[model samples]
Target chain A: MRRAAVSTLLWAYAAVALLPLLIMVWNSFRTDQELVVEPLGLPHSPSLDAYREAWVEASFSTYFLNSVLVTTLSVLLSTAVSLLAAYALARSRSRLMAVIEQVFVSGLMMPVFLMIVPIFYLLDTIGLASTRTGLILVYSAVSIPFSVFVLATFLRQLPVDLEDAARIDGAGPLRTFWSVLLPLVRPAVATVVVFRFVPIWNDFFYPLILVRDRARYTLPVGLTTFFGEYQTSWSTLFAGLVIATLPLVVLFLVATRQIVAGLTAGMGR
Target chain B: MNRRRTAALPTPVALLFLLPAAALFAVFVLYPMATALTYSLFSWRGTAQDAFVGPANFVALFTTEPYATQLPRAFGHNALLFAGAMVVQNSVGLLLAYALHHRGRLRRLFQVLYTMPYLVSPLVVGYLWSLLLSPLFGPVNAALRAVGLDAVARPWLGDPDTALWVVVLVTAWQWVGFPLLVYGAALGALDPAIEEAAMLDGASSRQRFWHVTLPLLMPVIGTVSVLTFIFSMEAFPIPYALGGSSGSPAGATDVMSLLFYRTAFHSGASNAIGISSAVAIVLFVVIVGISVLFTQWFRRVERRLT
Candidate 1:
């Protein structure tokens, strides 16, 4: 009886969480009026009109492409920069490592709003504000600390004997880092990629501040343009939302273990 | 083993990796923080030139008629959101984590489901929930009718009075799983026999939980709370996505971060950078104070626990 009760509560909470999602998907497949009238019931006649409207009317394609570009570049840059820094910190074992550690930790906690004016002024001074590259730089800088934390744990746990073995085999430090340590940290690297991608993909803040032109809009900020002055067509907005959300959700469902392992890197062990 | 390597790298290679991160952080973090401090003292425009206005800006921020209305509301709104998240998010998280601590067949399934909302973009969440809570034709209203609770229908995110709480509810829903998993990991590391002994005693489940489990959960709780507090102060996207930063319905949902954003950069405005930097500086000091206090508390808890 207790077991049954527990499962029932579990299922109910799951239902509460998933129900809104289901409603979004369902509404996107129906007429807006139909969604309003019989929202709790199955769709009377589903259609592809919302997706069509979102694409043709909303210019979602531009935003989607922008998201793809920004996500790819930011994740690549941040992960590359942090990986080298983390490897150096791991191997060298200097007091400067403590400074590096402190810098990243505070960066992690430092609210992005606190730096908005200065960064904007500086970016604008350099002629990069309101551009995709500017957003990419900001994303990379903000993401470094946590990525370092994740990579540091994994790299520290890595056996130094592997490097010793490679060095004795006549590999230099750089070559040993590549041939020996890099292969072992593939999971950590994937973690960094997804970690940066999901946030940059869905981010509305920096884009809202940085990107001025609608032509340069990323997905999340572009989706808001459809909201209008008062109300949006609910069905069409839902379609736009689903398209924007699906990539990360699909990736997450497939790689649940890696994400969890990354999040709980030190704590789990 | 020397291929010209003696405990270091050639300068160019070291600079190659470090330069990008260092340059960005310098321009963004260090200079911005310093700029915020200087900007807060005087009135200035987008450019470097400024007028020496002394502490007039600080005095104006306090004694000005408009700020009187703004400050209390911003702090109050954030506090309500913070308290709501602490109760709803952390408690639900602890319960879920406790229930799912053992790795059973359904473990992976629940984990994914719990973390699913977290993965969705915050903008989508704000959009999705506002749609769900729409009074005219939302499914929530339909479900309320189906369940014969029509009288409980609410304006939800629409009304000025209830809008902030609606944001808080959604925020809690999205973020709770994080703390739960953090605590769950810590709990999994604890020796089971100690908990078993307490349970085997004459103590009730409640007694054992309070006298034993809650105390043991303190360290993780401390760490998680500090993280949550910092996050809560910085959490702008959901509210911004929901009602917007200037806030809807007479700025009812405005937080300090949003206020600063609006003041500094109003939809690609050409100027107002200096004024916005001043607001951000005040925000920085507030954040630094809170984080330092939490760090001290975390250390105290750490020392006591260990």
Candidate 2:
């Protein structure tokens, strides 16, 4: 009886968790009129009209491309810089290095709202305001603290005998780091990459504030406006949401282990 | 091998390795934070900085008409969100984790399923929930009416009484997976011998859980609480997506972040920058202070456990 009760509770919670998405995908194929008439009913004949309308008319294609470009560039830039810094912080025993590490770690507490106004002014001063490049740069900066913390923690736990052996084999510092250390920390790198990717992909704040041009809008910002414009067209709005959500779902399915590992890494003793 | 060769990178090369991240962080994160501190001290004429008002902006924030009222209300909402998340999300997560730990069947699949909502954007999640809860055409109401329970159906997102709770529930729905995974991992790491010994001592499952497992899980619980506190206090996207930037339904769902956004960008108040920066600084101090204090306390507790 207890085992049955447990199973029932788990299954119920799982249904609650997934039913919304399933309903969304199920309804996206129906027309707005059909949805208004029967909000809970299945589509009579599934169609791609809503998808086509969202993709072609609503400019989700552009938003899709922009999201892809911005998320990819920002994650790559932040992860690359953080890896080098993590390596340095892991290896160095200097007092200054410790201070620098503290500086980066302290950034974990820095609120985005606090820095946003000044960042706007600073970006404008540098002529980067409203540009994808500027947004990418800000994303990188915001992501660096967490990336460094995770990578540095992982790097510290690694044994250094491999690096010593590489040095004995006449490998230079750069060569040793690139060839020896990099391969070993691949899991850490993957952890940082997955963790950074989701937030950057999902962030609407920076883009909403910094980017002015419609052409430059990322998916989250674009979807907000898209919803505004398509307020009456529920099916099309659902289609747009599905488009915004599908990539992450697919990615999660592909990389569940890595994502879980990254999420649960430091939580346990 | 020498200890130096084994551990230490040469200083020059280490600095070189650090340069890119240091530069980016200094220019973007550190510099802007410093500038925000400065901006919060002064008066502003539209976009331009004016006379140094010392703490007048902060004073106005606490004592003035709109801000005094708005700040406290928004702060209450945030506190409510934190408390709600702790009671609802974390508790549910612990139960789920405990069940999964014992069952072990389809654990990976369940983890993936449970965590799926977290991977999607909050904006999308918010929008999706808004549709589901929409009074006019939402299936929730439709199903309610269909079941002859029409009295239970109402404007969930439109009602001020229920709007903030909806946000809380949605936020919990998206994030419960985090605590679940964390607690699950902590449970897995626990030595089973202790629990077995308790079983031998004739402790009931409930007694063992309450006395043994719960105390051992205190550190992980503390960590989850701090994270939930931070996320709740800084919440934006769901509230923004569901309630708009002004935190609609007559500002019933207004949060500190939304308030800051409005004052800075939308309000067009003369000293918008100054006032908003003050708001930001207040939130920062609160978040950092509470987080540090709790983390230290949790560390002491963890040390005692061993």
Candidate 3:
């Protein structure tokens, strides 16, 4: 009886947890009138009209493309740069490297709130503001600390013999890092990519502040404007929200173990 | 192992490898932090500082009208959210972790389901809850009324009294999955031999958990606490989405991050940049203070446990 009660509780919470998503998927096909009249019921006749409308009318395509471009570039650049730095930090036997690694790790605690104003100014001064390149640079920069943390730790655990072998073969520092350490830390690279992708895609604050053009708005920021403009259209707004969220959800579903492991990897042994 | 062979790679090579990350960090993170500090010290109109404010911006946060009135109230809301997360979210996650710790297949299944919402964008979560809590068509109100408790059904995100709490619950709901997984992993990693020893000592289940399992999980708990506090301090999306950027429904849901965002970008108030920078500094100090405190606490606990 006790075991049954415990299982029941777990199952109940699981149901609660999944309910909103199920509702979202369900209501995206629903009309606003249907939603108001029978909010608890599944859609009697599901339609893709909301998705179509949100796509064409709400300009999610522009926002979607911008997000993809920014996230892909940012993650790729950040992870690659971090791999080099992580290689140096992990393989080196110097106090300076140790201190640099510590500084990078400590960067994890620095909130974007403190840096947003200055970053805006800095980008504006460099004439990169309101451009995808500017946003990409900002994303990559912000992501460096955490990626370096993960990558450095992963690289540190790897046996030093491979790099030694590469060195004996007369490989340069860049060659040794690329050929030896990079392949070995592929798992951490994937982890960093997945970890960084979600936030950059979902980020609203920077986009809201940095991007002056509506054409440059990422999905989250665009979706907020959509929410504000179409406040009354529940169905379309749900569609937009669903569209905005679907990529990360799909990524999480496909890479559940990696995402979970990557995130919790820092919780200590 | 030739020390001289490894040394041949040289400092320049390492420095070359460090250049890109160093450049990016220097430009974006370090410089910006220094800029925020400097900007906080001056009275600025738009992008240009006109006079040396000398801590006046920070002082004005307390002495002024909208800021002074809103700052404490916002902090109160943040404290309430923090408390709710610690007490409620942590407890739920802990209980779930304990119940599912040994369930194998069921545990993995629950882990996936519980963490599903967390992976969804916070903006989406905010929209979902606001829709779910809408008085007219939301399922929450519908379900409440259907169950014959119409009196308690509310415009959860629309009322001043209930808006902050609703946002708190949404924030907790989105994040509780994190601690659940962390605790589950920690519990799974506990030594089976220790658990067996505890059982063989004639300890009841409760005693076994409290005396053995709980003590061992202190490090993870501490880590999760600090993480929770930092994330909560920087929390912006959910409240911004549900309550609007002004932390609306009468600023009941206003947080420091939201306040800073508005002051700097949206407010258009005079010297808003300086004041907002001051707010950012406060947030930074709070986060750093909490992280250091928690790390020290975790070390002490680990030392005691050993």
Candidate 4:
């Protein structure tokens, strides 16, 4: 009886967690009229009207592609730069190295809001404002603190003998980083990739402020536009929400272990 | 001699490795911060510096009508959101962690499901909830109607009294997974023999939990609280999406971050980069203050535990 009670509670919590998403997917398939008339009922016809409307009329495809480009480029750039810095800090025993590590760790405390005003001014002055390239650079910059923090922490725990052996074998510092150390720290890289990619893909603030043109708006900003345009069209709006959420959900489902492991890597410590 | 011998790479080589990250950090973060400080001292319209305002913007932020009034109100909303998330989200997360810690088979599945929402954009989460709670066609109201609770199903996001609370609930719902996973891992690593000892001592389950398990979990709890507090202070997208950029419904769900963004960038409002910078500074101070306090307290608890 006690075991059954615990199981029931677990399942109850699961239901609460999943019910909204289930409702979202279900409503995405129905017409807006059907949604209003039968909000809780499953669609009788199961048409894809909402999805079709959102994709074609709402310009979700454009927004989707913009997000893909930004997220991909930013993650790649952030991971590479962070790995280099982490490799340097992790392997070196100099006081300067220690100080640099502390600096990056302290960078974690600096709020993004504090930088937003100045970043806008700086970007505008440099003629990079409202461009996808500009947003990509901003994303990469913002990701550095956490990326370095995670990568450095992971690297510190790794054995240094391999790098030393590579050096003894006449491998150059650059070569060792590329052919030796980088491959060994693939798990940490995966962690950084998963952690950075989701936020960049889901980012709204930078895109909202940086991208003035409607053509350059990322997914979150584009969704805001959709929300404004389709205020009363409930099913269509639901379909847009599902489309915005589906890629991340699919990515999370595929890389669930790595994502969770990356996110919670140091929490238990 | 020992340091030189043990060094893994040459100084120049190490510096070479660090250049890209350092340059990016300097250009984006450090440089911008310096400019934000300078900009806060001047009355700037967009990119043009009009005049040196010195501390007038900060003064107006503290003493004036809307800025002064709304800033505190927004902070109050942040406090309430922080408290609600701690009480509702973390508590449920704690319960879930306790339930799932020993159940090896289903833990991964539940963890992934609970955490999936966190990966989705907050914009999506906000819109998703708004749709879910739409009075005319939402499933929440439908369920309420089905169960004969029609009167209780009001316009959740439209009413000022309930709008802030709805944002709080939405944030908690999305974030509960973080604490669950953290606490679950902590719980799993706990030695089973300690719990057995408490059981053998004739302690009731409640006593065992409070006297044994709870004390052991204090350090993790402290870390989670600090994280939740920081996230709460920076919360924007949910309130922005649900309450509109104006934090409508009579500014019911206005938060510091949202207020800053609106004051600085909203085309409808007069651009007050100076005042907005002051708001950003205040927000920064509050976050740093809370983080220091939490870190000190956490250290104390960890010291006691050790």
Highest TM-score against the true fold, candidate: 2
Q: What tens-digit string does per-residue lDDT give for candidate 4 at B217-238?
A: 8788888889999999999899
Of the true interface contacts, what fraction does each candidate have?
0.49, 0.81, 0.66, 0.68
Off by over 4 Å in 4: B1-7, B267-271, B301-306
Candidate 3, residues B1-306: lDDT per residue as tens digits?
543335234667777888999999888888887777788899987788889969999999889888898878777778777877888666888888888986766677799899987888888899888888888789999999999999999888879999988988888988898888888888877889999998898988889888898888888898888878888888888988888888988898899888888888888887889899888888788778878987997898789887
lDDT of 1 by residue, B122-195 (tens): 77988888888888787877788899998877877778988888888898888776776677777777788988
Which consecutive 10 residues in model 2 chain B have the weakest lDDT in total?
A: B1-10
Model 1 TM-score is: 0.91
> Candidate 4: global Cα-lDDT?
0.85
What ordering of candidates by lDDT runs from best to worst?
Answer: 2, 3, 4, 1
Which lDDT value does model 1 have at B63? 69
The candidates' interface RMSDs, in order, read 3.5, 1.5, 2.1, 2.0
Query: TM-score for every candidate vs. truth?
Result: 0.91, 0.97, 0.96, 0.96
What's the TM for chain B in candidate 1?
0.86
Question: What is every candidate's alpha-carbon RMSD to the true fold?
Answer: 3.2, 1.7, 1.9, 2.1
Cα lDDT tens digits for candidate 2, B45-78: 9999999989999999999979999999999999
Question: Which pairs clash inside model 1?
Answer: none
On residues A1-269, what C-alpha lDDT tens digit does candidate 3 reach at each position? Answer: 17888899899999988988888888999999999999898989998889998999999999999999999999999998998898888767777888888878878877688788888888889999899999999899889999998888887777777778888789888788777777788888889899999888888888988898999989988988898898888889889988998898789878888977876775647
* Pairs with steric clashes in candidate 4: none
